[model samples]
Target: MDVRVLGRGPAEPFLGAQDLFETEYDLSMPVRVRIRRDPDERTWTGHYPDHHVLNISAQAATSAMARELALHEYAHMRRNEEAHPSHTQSTAEALYLALAGRRVERRKLTHCYQIANHMKDIYADDITLSVAPADKLVAFLEASLATALADRPHDPPRWQRLTPAADPDITAVNAAFALALCERHDLLTPDHRLYDLAHAAADDAPGVSIERFKHRFKTLVDDPDESEYRKALVDVTHQYAVETGQAAD
Candidate 1:
């Protein structure tokens, strides 16, 4: 496999990450590592059957966390190669089928996609954590949730619903994702900071049951066949729509 780093930024970290990931998984395709300067654009992987690209923001590539981030994206690339349901299926179609005839708000429907994405992340992290330490990934999640919680409104105005970042449902799903990751990796402890933030999110969005979504996503069977994964997606979408009062009576 040809792995090329295409940036002025240091290539050692990314190349080292490729070596680590290749130990556990076969990277059969060529890979290009592109570094961009956009802070808001996160490190992500784009995959085609024959080749893949791992794009990292300049800020992230320069940071010590680059290897961890690259490993996570590499796991995603591996899953894509394997045709994993989380990486292959249409989340929107699953939501439409799950909530058929129910008029869902566009915002709520969007949240469903985020929930589905959390599932994908969980599976990808499973592969990553197997090959690397979980400390960096765990720390990243903690810092992200802490920031979001600090920025959240004590009581968001009804008008803030127009923004997903300000939407309580979005926060609830975010919290669920945090909880699901902790659960899947057995990272939770009584003193862990995530416990409090997740509880705060749950209390803030009483209409959305964080546990329900957390359980559904966290317990998804590894290497699930298409039907099983689709069913899981449908179930979570329907549950989220109903909980958020998106179902037309």
Candidate 2:
């Protein structure tokens, strides 16, 4: 897959890996990866960002987990992390409102607002949120494509490598958005990304223990006995169900 330098601005050389990469690796930003010492050469260490990087240590990565990570990082890079995040209440929202100009619609905005809140909760521990509904994200993609097509009709995204989300910089926004949406869907089903990844590996470390995973997840939300986590989870689930037309309560 050709590394698509996010359509926001002028394309430049890709980043990372001096010895291994002959050419630039088109990686988007907010990139996250785990670094490991190469088994063959402990003197040299290998860096594996989410999964866009072609050079990966097979022994280091567990199947497609690395790939998923790279993709996730790439999506973060491409999506609304730069000038505009996917969801910001004040000026940012107004900006998207101006550009999309009532085209954005209330549902998307509200949904994205919820998306922001989730991100806030997720990153509350430490990571931090730059901007969710980043203006650069939507603006860049929309403007880029609008300009690109204005000259001559181009292709309709060759292989869905990454999606064009709102905001600026990178090209993985769509992937991130879709993935987040899927995760939200799954979680309302109350599944964690870890569980999904573990099951995908199917390593058979032990018997399938969904209950064990749930217990672990309950800790993750900071003691389900605590009112805030429980209430938030309940509200998020209810909202999802109501929106998706699967509302039981």
Candidate 3:
């Protein structure tokens, strides 16, 4: 496998990450990696499966976050090669629920995509951590939780300004709950601080309790039964729409 690092940044760190990823995983084809700064980029790194390109943000590269990002994206690339019927099914169900209603707006549909993508992240994180070093994975999870906690509002407004009906607090809690579920399942190490932060966020969100939220999240991502998984997705999407005042007709 030929791994090339492009664009300007600290080449050594990125090269080191590439070396580690190549050594740990088998790549049958060439892949291009680059680091670029984008203020609007929502992720630390993204994998373009079709182009076989991986892009890491300059900020993430400088902070040593590129290592995990690379490995995570590599896992995604590998998964792309091996078909996952379950992911395909679940994603389809979520999208159907998200767009089933006549009231669906672009932003609302985008929010559904966000939730579905995060659901995929849980599976990808599992694959990456399976082969990657446990300590390194733990460190990455810790850093991720710390960043989420820092950026989260202590008392968020009931609804986002742009999406008046969508409760930002609930969305944040759901995201945190996904990570917390990973920790619970041993994909990531359990950290009291991370759990506390998730719990606190749930507490502040009306009608959301920590334990109940965890159960729903687990059902959404980890449930073995396909029917139950679809049901969970429907329930989650319904809740989001209800909270946002965009319930389907």
Candidate 4:
């Protein structure tokens, strides 16, 4: 792995993370790490068969979750190398297959992609959680959902209006994903506080059945084939579209 600093930021975090990750997983191909000076730049990892690139915002590189985030992205890299169904199939393709002729609003289209992302995250986290502790990931989800819920608008019912960040319907879906992931790993107890947050999100978005989606996403089989993954993605997308009133003509 080659660490390349783009503008200005500490590369030590990434180096440390790479060391930690390489301790458990083998790095077969070359990896380039780009650290951007801009704090606002989006942090992500791009996986290719020949090489891999990791881009990190200066701000994100300083965060506490940097190592865990790197591990998660590296897990994605490994899966992509293996041609895992979650990494091979494009969610957009599945969305099209699921709602080709349906009348879905442009605004709600983002949610479909977000839900698809949750499915991919589930598989990546499966690898990540095996090596790293789930503490940071779990904490991040709880804090994020709690903040979204607390920042919800006061005007009109939550389902009536959609703000990109604090939309209750999206928050509900996020909570469902969090609950499903945690439950699938047995990370939370029956009386955990996240359950309360999930319940609160469900109450805020009456149109979405959070429990059903939770169960649906939670039972995903491990290492499914390409067809199975696409089928699950399409089924979940269609269900979410219809349940959230996005498929209405």
Candidate 3, 1-249: lDDT as tens digits: 566778776766646656666666656656677777774444433434454677776776676566677777766666555544335455656667645755765666666666656555666666666666656555555565556555555554533354334344445545466555465556544554556656555655555444654556555444345565566666666666566554457
> 1 or 3, which is superior by TM-score?
1
| Model 1: lowest-lDDT 10 consecutive positions | 157-166
Which pairs of residues have clashing backbones in candidate 3? 165-244
Candidate 4: regions farther than 4 A off: 1-7, 157-165
lDDT of 3 at 35: 71
Residue 95's lDDT within candidate 3 is 66
- When summed lDDT is taken over every stretch of 10 residues in candidate 2, the lowest stretch is 166-175
Candidate scoring better on lDDT of 1 and 2: 1
- Give each model a TM-score: 0.92, 0.21, 0.71, 0.92
Q: How well does candidate 1 score on lDDT at residue 152?
A: 71
Q: What is the lDDT of residue 26 in candidate 1?
A: 69
Candidate 4, residues 225-245: lDDT per residue as tens digits? 889999999998998889887
> What shift in Å separates residue 137 of candidate 3 from its native position after superposition?
5.0
- Backbone clash tally (model 4): 0
Off by over 4 Å in 3: 18-24, 37-51, 86-93, 102-108, 134-167, 174-178, 184-191, 209-213, 216-235, 242-248
What are the Cα lDDT values of the candidates?
0.82, 0.31, 0.59, 0.83
Best by lDDT: 4
What is the lDDT for 115 in model 1? 81
Predicted structure 4: lDDT: 0.83
**Candidate 2 wrongly placed segments (more than 4 Å):** 1-34, 37-60, 80-82, 86-117, 120-180, 183-249
